[model samples]
Target: MTDSRDVVRRLREGFAWRDTPVGVFADLSGWWRDPELLRMLGPSLAGLHADASPTVVAGIETRGLVLGPLAALPLGVGFVEVRKEYRVAGEGQRDGADPMLRAGTPPGYQDGGLTLIAPRRLFRPGDRVLLVDEWIETGAQASAVRRMVDEAGADWAGVAVIVAACPPEVGERLGVKALVTDDQLPG
Candidate 1:
């Protein structure tokens, strides 16, 4: 297995920041471009929650969509996509028959808040779900995802992320583990 420190080093090497009119933007595109980092990322994140023995991995939309599947591959589990304000046809539609579980997140570093949605059928009553994402700033989305997991009757295994920028108490409450803390980022 690759050393966790090596992984962190590689992440830092690939990561960058860009200035925009609005604010500084994190350019994580490097993470996806490196083959070795891609190979190690899933296992590294999954390792954090291996003790939890999560039966399934759940990722929020966008970046989470990529990281979630990677983590799930190493754990020998399935991946579930938690979308943002996903809409479907009426309940009569076959694909839309299963109602989606929705939860509103609190204000975060980016926007005010977002509504997370997932199909009820994807999560089983006793599933141990570990949520994965690239970064977490406010823990708002993570908390909301946990709530959705609860509403789906699934067990909250924990959260795994590339960067953890949320407050210490928030991270502890959410049972979050990360590859690096926000302060560790290069200035």
Candidate 2:
């Protein structure tokens, strides 16, 4: 089986690197400009799904949308999206409590006190979930998602990211294996 390092190499060959909106940072994306590259990277991300051992794949909004399902495909698991698109005055039966509105969060997004909402209740009690993202920096988002999964009595199987910039403790604190390391990311 190909290792994570090999996978990163494959990704680099298959995608284009671009700067984030901040104009001072860069990240890799599956190249829309190159079909062959997309073909390569899509499957590459999917390959991580197998390594993750997840009953379902959960992803954050925005960047996570790009990879959540792709990673789930290889694991033969369903996909879930954790987003704050709705508002709840209190903790409802299905919908979580409304996020505490922050000073700088988006208009519709509430703090949710760091709760994660799985898309359509994709996860169940004791379900093993593999969380995925394109990048993991501070790990706040992933941590919030894990808390939600745990509160629902689910198991966090592991976390896979294309780029992991945080130190090892971040994964430990979040209670997951950093399946891919910074050295394994496309450089």
Candidate 3:
């Protein structure tokens, strides 16, 4: 079975530094298809926030969707999809104006960023949630989720990521736990 060290190695080998309009971000189109990577990543990442004993796991977007549920599985919690540029059908069961729909963008993907959309009902009042993703750059996505949690009156349990490259302030402010640190990234 793959271990956390193997996961780190795979991530570094898979990802490359790319200078985007926003800034330097990791082009992580590297290990998406590797089920083994995720299998190893799930429990390891889950371990980060499992101490909080959250009732739900919310994944931010495409990457969040993959890692969130995978991490949530071992945590024995349900997974929630924080959709981007998409809306869920039958949510709120209302036409036109659904109070459940929420949309915004993370600060990290400023230029040509995708509009993120999620249902407020995905979480409930007082529900504890652990947010999961593969990478965190600016804590913008994590902040958005924190806002949603506040709007719903849910408890922001914690944030977890497979790799991190953002400033230490981001993690300190959000209390995010990353499996891989900045030094581990391929420079």
What local lDDT does model 2 show for residue 87? 43
- Listed in order, each prediction's TM-score against the native is 0.92, 0.66, 0.81
Q: Write the per-residue lDDT of candidate 2 for residues 30-148, one digit (tens) a residue.
A: 43455554444435655654554668887777767767777776567788877653443254555573333111222333333334455434567878877777777667777667777
The alpha-carbon lDDT assigned to residue 16 of candidate 3 equals 83
Scanning candidate 1 in windows of ten residues, the lowest lDDT window is 86-95
Q: Cα deviation in Å at residue 50, candidate 2?
A: 4.0
- The count of backbone overlaps in candidate 1 is 0
How many steric overlaps does candidate 3 have? 0
Global lDDT of model 1: 0.89
List the pairs of residues colliding in candidate 3: none
Residue 91 alpha-carbon offset, candidate 2, angstroms:
16
The CA lDDT at 143 in model 3 is 82
Error of 3 at 129 (Å): 0.9
Judged by TM-score relative to the true structure, which candidate is superior, 1 or 3? 1
- The candidate scoring highest on lDDT is 1
